[model samples]
Structure formats: C-alpha cells, structure tokens
Target: MKDTPRFAPDDRPSGGWGSLKAVAVSMFREEAPISTAHALLKQNKPGGFACVSCAWAKPAKPHAAEFCENGAKATAWELTDKRLPARFFETHTVSELQTWSDHDLEAGGRLTVPLRWDAGLDRYVEVSWEEAFAAIGAELRALQAEQAESVVFYASGRASLETSYMYQLLARLYGNNNLPDSSNMCHESTSVGLKQSLGVPVGTVTLDDFEHCDAVFFFGQNPGVNSPRMLHQLQDARRRGVPIVSFNPLRERGLVSFANPQSPLEMLTPAQTAISTQYLQVKNGGDIAAITGLCKWLIEGDDAALQSGARRLLDAAFIAEHTQGFEDFAAFVRRTEWAEIERESGLDRASLESAAATFAAAKSVICVYGMGLTQHRKGVLNVQMLTNLLLLGGHIGREGAGICPVRGHSNVQGQRTVGITEKPELAPLDRLAELYGFEPPRKKGLNTVEACEGVLDGSVRAFIGLGGNFVRAVPDTQRIEAAWQKLRLTVHIATKLNHSHLLPGEVSYLLPCLGRIEIDRQAGGAQTVSVEDSTGFMHASDGVAEPAEDTLRSEAAIVASIAQATLAPNPKVPWSQWVGDYALVRDAIEATWPEIFGDFNRRFRAPGGFQRPIPARHREWKTDSGKAHFATPADLRTDPDTPEPDADTLRLMTVRSDDQFNTTVYSLDDRFRGIYGTRMVLLMNAADIARLGLAEGAIVTAETAVNDGFHRAVAGLRVTTYDIPAGCAAGYFPECNPLMPLAHHAEGSKVPAAKAIPIRLRATKPA
Candidate 1:
C-alpha cells in the first residue's frame, strides 16, 4: 500500500481545475471519448438517461452540459471500453477474486454473460441465459414449495421504475414480501420521519425552490462526494445572496466554498463561491439536540432579543393553523436546559442562537440533510425535529421553502415510488390485487437488518440481489457476509463485478444486465425507463450509447424473464408483454398507483416529465390529524446516562471518501480529506489525538463498543488529525462497516447508526 499521506486541504473540492483534471483522468482510465461525450450530453436532459450517481432532479430547462464531474465519472465508468469476458471468470476462482480490492474487482470491467459458480472447480463457468434462468427458477420454486417466506429479494437504488415494479410484483406473486432495498440502509429514516410529520415521505421542494430560498441548512451531508450535481444548486443559492448554514461533525469540503466548473470566470480564475456562511461542528449523534436547541431558543428567546421587538420568532399563526402538538413541543423545548444542549450538540449557546437567529430572519428556508442525520439511533426523530423547525416558520408549501432529503443513489426514491418496498401499503396492494389476480402478502417483511438476521438463522434459504453490493453496503460486513454464505441459493443481476458476487451460496449465479447509459432494445423497439428524482419529478431516461455487450439483457427483461420462468404456467402479470414493451409496465404502474402515475407513458415523454402528487407541497396534510404534527423529541437522557467516558473511547462515524459513491470506490485517494493511495485511515480531531497520546499517521485499531458479547474490530487504520469535533472520529465505510453492530440501529427505521458508532481506538502494535 502506498504510504503517502498528503495533508494539504483542498480549497476547491468538486469543481474548478480539480474537477477538470479528475474528469480527464477518468476518461483516460475508461478509454472514453466520442462515446462518453455523446452519452454525457444527453444525461439528465429531456431525451436522456438519468445519472447513476445521485437522485438530484434535472432542471426543467437543462443546459447542454447538465452533468457534473462525478456524473461524468459515473458515465465513463458505465460506458467503459473494457469488458470482462467469460474467459476472465473462468481463469479466476471466487476465492482468488476475493483477495482483490473493490476497485480492482470493478476495474476488471463490465460483466457480459451469465456465469454459475462451480463448487468442485471453485470457479465460475459461463452458462447460457436460458439455462441459468431455468436453474434459478427451479431453486426458487423448490424453496417456495417448502417455505415461500424463506427467500429474500433485494434491490439497489440503481433499479429503474419498470424494473423495480416488475421485481416487486415477482416477489409478491412468489408469496414473499421480503423485498429489502438500499433505502433501508440510507434514507429509511427520512421516509419514516416525513410520513409521520408531513404526511409525505419525500422532499416537498423542486429544483426551482433552491433559487428562491433565503437560507439552506445542511446537516450531516457531503454533497461533493455524495451528490456533486447539488453543488450547482448550492452555488446558485449562494450567488443569490442566500446564507447557507452547515451543521456537521466533520468539516466537509462540499459544505465549504466551491468553484463552479461551468462558470467561465471561476473556471479560468482561482475564485470560488462560498457555500456555507457559518459551519457548526456538531458532535456525532447530536443532531437532534442541536435542532431541538435551535427550536428551544426560537420558542423562548433571549430577554434582550425579545425586548428588541424580536418577539415573533415562532410563526404562531402558521403553527396554530397548519400544525399540531405546539404546546407540548414548546413545553419540552423550554424544559430542556442549555448545558445539556451544549454538551450533546458540542456547540455553545452563542453558535446555536446565531443559527436560530439566521433561520428566524429568513422569510423562506430549506432544510437539507443526508445519512448523517438519518444514520443514528434517533434517526427518525432527528428528521422529525427538522420538520418541526420548518413548520414553526411555515417553511413548507411555499416557493424556496421545504424539507430536502438528498438521496445517495440516482433512483432510490424512484424505486420506492414504483413499489420496491417490503412494507406494501394497503391501497397499492388492493390496486395490485384488483388489477392482477394475486393476493399480496399482508405480513410485514424483512428489512436489510432483519434479512441479514434471517440469513444467519437459516430461515432465508435463497437470496436474489437486483443491483447493489448488499454484503458490502450493509452494516456489520463480516458477519453479514458469513450469514450470506449460509444461503442455499444466491443470484445477482448486475452490470459489473462486485464482492457480493464472489460470496455465493451452494447454488450461485451471476446474471449480467444492461446499464442505464446503454441501449435497451427489445422486440417492440428501444425502451425508456422512468425515475422519480428527490423532488418527485418522474422523467424518462433513454440510453444513447451502445451496450457494452450485446449478450447483456435489460433489467426489465431479466426481471420479467425470471418471473416468467418461476411462475411459468399462468403468471398473474403479463411478464412476456411487459418485457417486450416497457410501456405495458408503465400502464400497469399507472393502473396500480393512479393518483401519482396517471398517464405515465404519455406524460413521461413531456419535456421535463411530470411531478408526482405531493400533498405536503400544497400544505395539505394526509396525516390522521389533517395537519403537520410535531413529534416528541428523542430521549436525550440516554447518552448522558452512560458511565464516565473511557480514555480510549471515541464516537466513530462511517463516511464516504471523495473518490467514491456509496460502496463504489472510483479511486483510493480522498482529495478533500488530503488522504492519498489508501482507504485505511481514520480522521480524528487534532486535540483528541494529542489527548490520546497518538501522533499523526499513527497506526491504530478501533473496536466496537457493543455489549452483545461479540468482538468487532477494524485494524490497521492510520489515524490522521483533522478539524472534526472533539470525542468524534470518522472513517471510510465498508472498511469501517465491520465495526457497526446490526442491533445498534434507529428505533423505528432500523437504519444502522453508522454515523454514531461507539468505538475504542488503540495503538496498533507492530506485528
């Protein structure tokens, strides 16, 4: 491993010359030029494919160059000239490939054909698509015959609307609702919180809202790495003189100033638009406290401030008219003390008051958050508190004012909208059963956490992953992989090679599928899939580039074919017709979810597509109370109740490197964090490092603080000092995933508290 730890801070993270250089390097590595240029120009456009990196919506009138640097990287990676032929799989054993790094595994190139694992030879051998499908079908049928609930169908956020709809239909028809998805691991908290508070599970704002907002509050998100396209929106918000206040444990580059690559002056010069007007380094797991503190201040203002005619900090009229639980919420806020808030939030009263003052002064505001707020034990409450803050000032149902949850995957929200959920609503189920003569399962199914537990207990006999690297993406990596190995059958439908493919079951198969940027031609004609963005706009995504390999099947085709083979005699749904004409799937979707997806085919072809109905957008609450509700605050007494802190103990947060998106690592270098040629590094506060008697670049190991009597540790991580909050440390995920206990998840959402892992760091003794 290269040991060069560059400590220079990146003044310009995503855009400017840095983005250009990164783009050039990615194109060179992927051998992309004419094909990439042709493909990129169409990405996020009216007649183009959605970017695979993020769920940020395409502007109604997108420019010719609508894609960002990371989007370009994703496009190049998808449209790479390199190919992983059948011979390559034949030459390497599963165990041998397991030794390869994640980047190396993907660097092997795109998968082109179906391959089945041969236990005797310990290698994967090429198999015909028909034979592979037939074998998988037989196993699934056998499992269903014995116990229908013994199978799990997992989906990645990369799944398109048509594919997601088909996958869920197949799962429900196959007598199982064990449809765990990537959302469970990331934004499940957002879904649960929003649904409870605002009567909508998605953000209520559109792309145009950013332009009108006076201030944007970013909590626990690094947009530069997670969603680079959002930088443009932030840049525009900043240019409009809107103050952006950031609340994060770590000082993220994306939350700092950013140089826009699209701007001629900034691109040519060294100037950059400042992103955050104030950056508050809140402690890990302290988001709820911070937000609640702000609310408390807004409710019971300073004596001096109140005397200065700043009495109407809270929108009493809006709260009385459009919200509930104000009295109880205000009582809790008034009772909560400043010392406790300061201790939990790691921010003094001055800072919290300043942020609250900024919000109070603004007429229109948008509260934005990511996994940082959601991946906590109180994740759902964290989200609700933000909504409460917004409701106090009437930040919803108006231009430039609403809640925004920045999703990691390009179509994660879209997948949920199209019924890729384990918890199926009664309306959708009723509609589905009415349209297709199948009784949908009523029992609540296994989520990501429960699925892993099910696999371990030998209850889930078979597993089928639609696109994501499930093993690596979920928490408790080693344990989850071991449980995954216990499966009787495992199948992965994917576009590229991942570690999950190597950790197969007794009967394992890899089914290659077409990517988003590739042509998806069927018997009828070229097909287009629709996806819902973060803002709820449903748009068409048509591939402009040729397939990496002709043998690769569309995700829709694979799902439909699997359903056809598994439910052969008389499938409830028209699998063959759906595969042949994707429009049929859209028709089915519209029939099922008519309220939102009416005329999907006809409307999706419109310039910017159609917006999904959001009652919250129009200040119409669909909740039981018929108004937005202020949910109870999380029990802040829990963390403080723990015995005095140990010297070695630190709060660990699993974070993404700048070179990666989710589990896909584009490179080892984290340019923003100043780490190079390695993923095995821990970012710690400089003062914390000094107190622990550890020098910079010191090799260390972090052990999880779980009382479950199981030892979980990640070793050989080099500690690097940074400007994070004291008692808080951060590290790259998948690498740090092993340190997260599955049981340590949010109360309601079950999203692993990846951002608030209790860890004990120790010096790594020389071997």
Candidate 2:
C-alpha cells in the first residue's frame, strides 16, 4: 500500500478527454495493434460480439463507436498478445504466484493450454485436453457415486447464453442442482423481490422506455463507472428536458454531470450536460426510509387535493384495477413519523417533500437501481419499497414507466433465464426431463453462501468454475481460500490467470478457453452466441478477431466435452453434435423454454434481436393474487438482519473504480474520484474523520462491528476524506470483501450485505 495517495479533486465532468485517454492507454498497455483494436471495437455493434463488460442495452440504431471506456478495456484485456506458456508456469510456483497482485497476475496474459497442479513439483504442468477431461471425469464420477450434491458448478456472467444453457444442463444431468452464478452475489434481491410483488423476476422496462419517460429516478447507481453506455440515454433525456433524480450515500460524479466522448460538439466545445436535476445523499442502508418518506408525502398531498376538490394526485383507477394491498401500504407510510424518516435518510423534510413534488407531477417514470440497493441486509425490502413508490402513481406496465435494476455482467440475467439457478422451481425441470429423457433433480441446491458453508464443512468435495475469480469475489475471502485447498477436485475454465487459479485444490486443473472477442471455430464454421441485456432484449454476438491460442476451445465445447466424458451415453443428449454446431444448443434451449424463446434461431437472426416476454410488462401478473402487490417493509431500518451499530461504527460500502470492472483491476487509479496510485485507501466524510479524532491521511484499521466471535479486520488502509454522508465510509470492492462476514447476508435473497457493512476504525501505527 502506498503511504500517500494522490488526491486531486476532479471538477470536470465524466466521459470527455479522460475517458478517451484511458481507452488509448489500455490499448497501448495490452500491446493491441491500432488496426486490430479498430476492427474488434467496430464488431461491438449490432451484429458483432457483445461487450463483455456491463449489461447496459445497446441501441437499435447504433453509433460508429458504440463501446465505452471500460468496454474497450475489457476487449483489450481479453485480446492481449501476451501469453503464459508451459515454461512460464515452470518458473513460477503456486506459492510464489499467490504473492502476486491480481493485475500483475492477469497481465501475464492469456492461458495458452490446459494445465494441472502437480503436488510433487509444487507447480502447474501442461496436460493434453483428452487426459485433462478423463481425469476430471474420473473425479466427478467418483464424487457422484458418493453424493452428487457434493459437487458445485459455478458459472460466470460473461459466458454466452448458449454456454450457460449447456453448462446448467451438464450440472443437472450429473444429478444435483448445485448451480450458482454471479447473480447470487449481485441482483438476487431484484429477482426475489420483483417476483413476489410484480409476478416477474426481471425488470419490465425496455431501452425504448427511456425515450418516453417523463422522469428518471436513480437509486444507488453510478452509471459513469459501472455502465458508461447508459450515460448516452441520460444525456438524451437531459437534452429533452427530462428531470433526473438520484438517491445515493455519496455524491457520485456520474450522477452530477457527463460530457459524452462520442459527441463531437461536446468534445470540441466546453459544453457538458448535467444529469441529475436533484441529488439526495441518503445514509447507507437508509433507502427504505427515504422511499417511505416519498410515499408518505404523496399520500398526504393526495388527501389534501381530494378534500379541496382538485385533481386526484394518484391514479385511483389504475390502483383499484391493477394493484392490491395499497390501503395497508398507505396506512404504514402515513403512520411513519417525519423525524424517523429524516434521521434515517440523512435528508431534511423539505428536501424529500420537494423531491416528492417532482415525482408526483411526472406522468410516467422509470425507477433505476444498482447493487448498492440489492447488496444489503434488507435488500428485498429495499426493492419492494421502490416498487411500492412506483405503484402509487401507476408507473408500471406502461410505455415509459417501470422498474429497472441495472445489472453488471453482460449475460447475467440471460444466465438466470436459461436455468443457471439453485432454485428448482425457477427452472422448468419437467420440460427439461421431457426434452432430455432423464429425470432432473427435484431437491433445491446450495446457493453461493450455502456452498461456502458446505465447502467449510467438507460436504462439498469438488468445484467446477465455468468462469470468474470466485475465491476473490466472495465474502470472508481469507476463510474461503483456506477451505478451498481441502477440496478433492477443482476445475477452472478461464481465458486468463487470476487469483482464484493460484489457489489450487488437491487435484485441480486450469483449462484455457477462448474469450468473447476471439473467433470460436467449430465444425459449424463460424458460430454466433446470444446474450440478454439488462432490458430483457436478446441479441447475437459473434467474434471477428482471431483466437489468442488455437488450442483454446469455446466455453460451450468445454462444457459439452466434460458432460460427454462424465455421463453415460444418453441418446437424448448428443453432446458431440451440439458441440459441433451451437444452433443445436439454441434449439435445445428453445425446446426447454418454448414459451419464452420460441423460434430462437430465427428471432436471434433478426436485426437488434427480440425482447423476452415479461408478463408484468403487459399488466399481467402471474402471482397468486393476479395483480401487482404493494409489499410493506418489515421495518423502517434497511439493515434489519444485523443489530443497530453503535455511535462510533460507520457503515462501509464497497464500490468499483473507473479503471476497474467488477473484480478485474485495469489500473490502480480511480480517475473519476480523483484518487490515483492506490486502491487501499478508505473514503470517509470530513466530519467523521474529525469526530473520530483521526488525521486526514492517517493509517487506520477497520474492524467489523459484530459480536459473531469472529475477528474480521483489514489493516493499513489510508483514510481519505470525501463527500460521503456522516457515519458512512467507502472503499473499493474485493479489497474490502474480506471485512464482510459471510453469514451477514440478506434474509431472503442471501446476497452478501456488501453495501452496508458496519465497521469501526482505529488509528494504526505507520508501517
């Protein structure tokens, strides 16, 4: 960790010369040829490969450069010319490699071939694909003989829909439904909450809905860094004079203003478009109270309006016809005192009422949120409360009105749609049985948190990761990594080396796979895969660049080969045939989900693809009540699972830097926040720093504010003052993941409460 971080407040708006310079630097750092970069970037358009970054929807009418700065970085990272050959592994032992930082480890570049950990040599050794599959098959078969539930199949969101479909199928055919993916860590709350209220697990809005929306309400989402492509829509909405309201703990730069790099006029001139018409700095874990305040103000105003013989404030007809439990929700909101709402939300009554005035005046609105709302103890409640606010004004199932949960990975939602889930009811097991001629598993599977528990208890013997650095991404990182070594078997299908790969099991294998930007050649000649965006629209993605290594296989082929080697010759599942042509995979998906993915191939071939059927979008509720339900929060506090923190405990939230994507670090700089050269700094409010009697740049140790008998702490973090709310602190993710307790998760969704970790800081001696 650096002793002093370069702290320069950036007054300029996001996405101008800074973004362009970052993109160019990434290309140069990866040694990507200018021509090759241009060609690959051009392919990020409609018919080309999807950006393996955020899941923001692409426009139907695309621009020449449709990619964002982070998108370009992801492309360059995948298409890097650097390669890790057999000799590279021979020189670096597993123990030695474990000491390297994540960025440096991946900078060694793409894995060229299959490699297996040799206990005798204490290093990884190259192995043939046939031998690798045979060994993995033997281990899986042995594990299945004991208990199929002992194995875990983890999938990453970067995979294509075809690959995810095949991967989930392989897990079920082997006997258990222990399938967990990236969604378990991020948007599981959105899925669980929306389904119970709106009768749909996914968001109802489309990209076109942004066009007709009268106002946009953003909750805890920083689009400039997480999904830069979304800035284009916000810019357009701003130009059209639509009001944008933002609710977050920190005053994020993305929500304040933006200068689109794609705009020649803005780039040439000093013009920058302001994004948020109103920015409210809510306290961490205070969204429920903030939303409740809005609802209360609206209902009171409605009462006064009706008594005075003015126009009805709420859509009374829509509420009566399309919703239920409104009276109970309204009663609860009306009873909620103003003092509690103001204290919890960290905003005055005047501000919330003023914001509510804007919301009530708008005819239609789009409520958008991100992981900050979903990664808390009362995550499900937070989502349902936001939905309740929309229902008050009948802002749903209409042309510009709905809830939008902005997802991170490109195909995360698609993965869940295609059956990468631990819940059996979510997947059509009966249909899968009819299609595959085998009975699927009926018992529920372990989710990510439960899987970690299983691994710790020695119940889960093996783990097969489709893609991702699971060990680094999960909470209680140190504990999980120690338990991971005791596992019997571990298999990672990856494009490049990461921290998770270095933590090998007793019998572990690292198999190289082709990245999204590279050409995937099979017997079908050239294949195109599909991914569902955050807006529920599905589209085709085919690579135009050459593969980093010819021996690297596609993710679909690898999963298919493993299935073939492990399972008996099942006539229904022609694994090899499906591997030869990916259309067979799509056909099988369509057969399994005929209602949603009807005519999968034909529809995918259409320009800009088609939207998946969302029942709630048409005002058709699939719930038991057959109507959208207004769900009241269990209590006012958003962090209900954990006890209220003491006065000194500041809630800590993990965030992503501008130069990073999820767990992948492109550089040490957080350009948007103006913090450079280090990620080990803690962001705190100036008042909190003074109250805690800590210096501006003092070295500190943050310990978990829990009585769980576990000593969880991270030391040597330099404290830097920022514009965060009092009693709140912020730090980059994965670095702060270790401080979170694995058991501290959402009650229903089970997503780790990363956004509201209670911690108290103490000054540390200078290192």
Candidate 3:
C-alpha cells in the first residue's frame, strides 16, 4: 500500500476537503486540482449528479454538503480524468479487459470516444459517431422489422428521468416494449410487497411527520453507510430525545458514530456523535422472526399499560378502524413457538421484550426500511407485517411517524413516477398514448428478470441501455453475458465504463455523456433537470462544472437526438426544445401529475424544495379494502424457488463494500471493514469459520448449487472474519455476483436473490 496521506472523512465542516479530494481524483480519472472535488461538491449545480454513489435518496432540502464519503467517491468515479484513449485499447484486447479487475477497468477512465468491437482482433476499435449510430440503428431496425421477441432494452437507475423517459418511448415507438429496468435486480421486491399491502409500491412517510414521532424503528437497513445523508435527520430526532432502534445483521460504523463534516466545530475536535440508541444485530432472514417476536411481545405480553393507569400500549381503536386480518395474524403468531423464534432470531425473550418495550412506550413511531426487508420469498408478507406493526401502534398520520423507504437512486422513484415501468397500469399507458398521439403497446413488457431470460433464449436480440451495467448488475453473470452475446446490437449512454459495456453484440456503441455536475448548455442559455428523491420530493438540478469533453452531451440531449434520428418525422412534445430547456419537460411532468408537480417550475424555486402528495400523512389507505391489512404467509419454510440449502452448505449473499456503489468500483479498498487491496474475499463469522475447519484468511471456493444451467459460481475466494451470523456468508457483489443464480431469485418479485445465494464453501490449503 502507498504511504500517501489520503483525506479522511469527518462529520464536521472543513469544506469536506478529504472527501472532495478523494472524489475529484477518481471522477476525472485525472488530477486536475485536488481541491476541485471539494469546491464543486458544495456547488448547488454540482450536488445534482444523483450522488454518483449509492441509490440513497437526495434530500429535497439541498443540504450544504448533501453528499457523503461513498457519495463523494461515486461522483469522483464519474468525474475522473482517466480517459480511455484509442491507444489504451491498442495495448489491451477485449479478452484482456475481461480479465482485468473491476477497480482496474474503472481506473482505465471515462470512455471519451465511441468504439465498436472488432471480432477478428478480439478487441474494440474506435469508430465515429455517424458510423456507430448507423450500425446500431440498422441492427435495431432489422430486429424491429422481424418483430423480434429476442430484443430487450435494459434501463439503469443511474439514468436521468429524461433519458429513461426517452428510451422507453423509443422502444415502444419502434414496436417493442421489452423494457427491463434496474428495479428487476434491486427493489422490485419492495414494489411487489408494498403494492400487495398498500396498492402503491412506494412509502407513505412525509419528512414533516418526523417532527411528531416519539420513536423510530429502522429495519433491515444500514443508514450510516447506505444512506449517510439521512443521518442528519436521525441526529435531529436524537437531539429531540426520540428512541432510535436499528435492527441489522451487521453493526456498521455509520450507525455507531458519525463525525459530520458539515458541522462547524465537530471537525476541530474530530468529535463523533453516537447515532442509534440501540443496535440489535439480528441474523439474516431473522427479520421475520424478530418482527414477529416484537409484535407478539407488544400484543399478548406481560406489560399492559404505563404507571398511574395510563393506556401506553397497542392502539386497539386504530387497529379496528384502519386495518384487517388482526385475528388471523395474531393466531398465526401464536402458532410460532417462542423456542423456534428465539432460535431463528438468535435473540432471547429478554432482547425481544426489550425492543418491544421501546415501541410499546412510545405513542407514535416511524418504521424505515430498505431492500433488506423486502428481498425475501415472503417479502410481500414481510411488508404487510411491518404495516400491521405500525398500524397497531397508531403510528400513522402524525409527526415522527409513518413508513419511510430510503430509495437508493435520486430518481429511481422518479423513473417510475414518469412511467418507466414494466408492470405499468393500463391507465397510465392509455393516458400517455392519448397525450402523445401514438398507439402505446398494451402488451406487458418484460421486467428485469424476464428480460434476461428473453435474451438468453434468443428471443431478445437488441438492447439499448440508458445507463446501468445490466450485464454486471444481473445475477448469474455467465448466463447474462452469454445472453448478451446473442444480441444483434447494444447501446449504452454512460458516464463511466463498466462490465456492461463489454457485453457486446454483433454491433455496439458506448456514448459518454456530461456528468450531473457539468454545465449542460445547448441552444438554451442554461438547463435544469427534475429529479425525485426517496421522499418523493422533486427538485431541479443545474450543472456546475464545464463539460469534460465536447462529445459529451446531457442525457436529455442525447435521448432527444437519438429519438429524432430513429423516429420518423418530428415528435409532438418538442423533443429538441425539451432537451435544451428541461423546464418544458417539467411542464410536461406537471401536466401528468398535477397533485404532485403543481407549479413544477415555480415551487422548485424555493430554497428548501417542496414535497409530493403523501396519502399516508392523512392515514389514507389506498388498498381495495380501504384499510392497512396484515397477510399471513402459507408457509415459512416453503421457499421452493430459493430452496433451503443442505446441512453442509450455507445461504450466501452478495453486498456492496462501504466504498463501492451498485456495480461501479471507486476504490479497491473498503476502509471501514478493514478490507484493502482486494475484493476477492468473503465475510463470515469466526464460529462458522471454525466449524468449517478453516482458519482466518483461508482461501475457499464458493459456487451456487442451483441447477438451472446458471454458473453462479466463482473459485478461490479469501475468507475474512466478520461480525455476522453463524450460517451466513457475505462477499462483495459483481465478485460474488457469480453466486446469485438468476432462476433462484425471490418467488413473487423475481429479484435476483443477491441477498440469498445457496452455496457450498470448500477451503483451499485448509489449516
């Protein structure tokens, strides 16, 4: 390791020099100026790049330093100075780049020029925009003419709403709606779960409601690392003396303590504030048991009311008026013996009782979750169960209360908001068709999972990705790569290079676009793009930096340009003007959802941005029954899709390192976990290691046993001791991504079981 001084992350304000330097260096793939990353970080225009890191929501408040350590690294990765000049490819073949590490490939820098794969040389050769576009158009046209079911369009969450909106429109216009969005791989389960329970696949919390909550229940999420921007809100709640309980498998640093780099004095002392009052390390899949135990402890428990005859318990009135299936849910809970619950949760009755006590004592509480709570076979049931818990506590409607699902991307929710969905309702499409003066496809398009299958079977031929590394993001990497190879054409509008770019077809093109921080000036004087955060809060993002390269264009412009080139005649929506001036696009958005985007441009002018309509604030339940309900799963151990593993094997999962985003590699090291210089490692508990007869740092080979022609396996991974459950193992994604069989995804949602890989581990050079 180099003994160079790298900027360290702090909780207090010193212009975030450390994080800025780290981010800027990696982004441009160059060292223009160390301080450039820091100065640009605070710039309002610079803050809009969707955080370039995790899918964590960007707050509506436009925080002074809205970004975090991981977020900064994400931005730097995009803003990197490293450029893949023509010669860089001359030195390395496609085969060579394929063998390169994730970090090494990323460090090769931004793809400044477009290139097409040279089949004979087994490498990529530089190509002009005209030729590249013509080749891509020809392939797509051929596929369309054949009425090909073998073609799919994969959309990434990293894409701007404008890009996504245009991509889907282009596909549908060309007579195919095989749009497989990023949600297929990540939060599709959340949508399935929430939709089953609440009708809408979104959270119901308003930020203002946090002011009235008495306690917060954080489940299956790591806020400190995954959503560091949310820490400020939690800290505010803590200052107000509200109890914050965290239930996660790993005890992360972000939840323990955070030194706010934006604080005026905290940086001087390097002082850190403890965040969570209680950190309950629940075992994996233990969420079901833990939640059940908490609910049981609250309902049929020893403690009934507070001292002096006050009713400080479950809200029976609310449960009766605003919910259903309590009797069935309670009876089901009764069937779950405490012994089994304790065994699965790894928590004794006392711990369960204690956690319930926190919720029981509070009048109003908020439950916040992420993909962790919903990425299971019973993910839908899991969501309903959480809703039941909240409703039972009368924690809907007022301040400091309601359900908060921290969205990962700045506009993932927005993408859905603008109709970039697979299982989209007929009403939205009808409305879109009516407004656009074109016939929309009534046929159900393939989702993320279905898209991969279509590709592998030769039914899906061509692919046009608006950002996202679909090939890398999808599970069963070998299968997806093979499927991608069968495609007639592939096009990606990206900021940086990833494995997805290498998933070539007969024809392919990589178009680098301007980053969120860069100034996007076209025919218009300036441009502002709309993005919806996790909270359903939409805001305008203006670019802050000069364009890295002239060839680079705004996502809006590129989408419009492609649309104009591909679609015959002119579009009715003034695609060209919308590209240069996104306000007109916001106007179009406002026309679609008036209740949410009212005064689309005017209200966004406010310093602290506005929020979208939250029906939950009024205790409004949109389900058919008009009440929050509970669902009892038919069976707990009957996940046939992701069947239980053999005794000798463990259920493995793939997770991102603290420093890494979805499939993008910012740094090879994960400083927080003490992992460095490598990602080819697995994290498991010491007891699991000992039981498997393996010493620390032992090399092991792990491969998924799912028999579906899916080679979700990787050989020779180093083992590292971590604070995890006995039967569980975790390795960084895209590396361990090989273990997640595409067919073994969650049942109802079909989201790749990235968090639930059934695998066997064998020690190499066993001690």
**What's the ranking of the predictions by TM-score, best on top?**
2, 1, 3
RMSD of each: 1.8, 1.3, 3.5
Candidate 1 CA-lDDT value: 0.87
Task: Give one digit per residue, the lDDT tens place, for model 3 in 1-767.
Answer: 43432223233321234444545545555454453465445543333444544544444456766677666666556555668876787888887777776677777777777778888887778887777766676776676678745567667775665666666776677666677777766677777777666556777776666777788988877775577767777777887998888887776766776666777666667666777788887766667778888888876752345334556477878878877788888787777888877876767888888888899888778899876766665565666678778877878776667778877765787787776776646226776676678887777788887887777777777788888778887777887786678777888888777787776787777777777767788787867665666766665566666777787777777677666666666457688778777777777777766777789889864544567776656777777898776777554441456555666677676777666777777676666666766787888888888888888878899977677764556877888888887787888888877677667666677777666567888777663
lDDT of 2 by residue, 512-597 (tens): 99988777899978888999999888888888788888889999999988998899889998888888888998999998888889
Q: Is candidate 2 or candidate 3 better by TM-score?
A: 2
lDDT of each: 0.87, 0.90, 0.71
Q: Kindly list the per-residue Cα lDDT of model 1 for residues 118-228, writing each as its tens digit.
A: 999999999999999999899989999999999999999998998999999899989878999999998999999999999999999888899899999999888887888
Which has the greatest lDDT? 2
Number of the top candidate by TM-score?
Answer: 2
Error of 1 at 745 (Å): 0.5
- Comparing 1 and 3 by TM-score, which wins? 1
Residue 177, candidate 3: Cα error in Å is: 2.8
lDDT of 1 at 447: 92
Clashing pairs in 1: none
Candidate 2 local lDDT, residue 29: 86
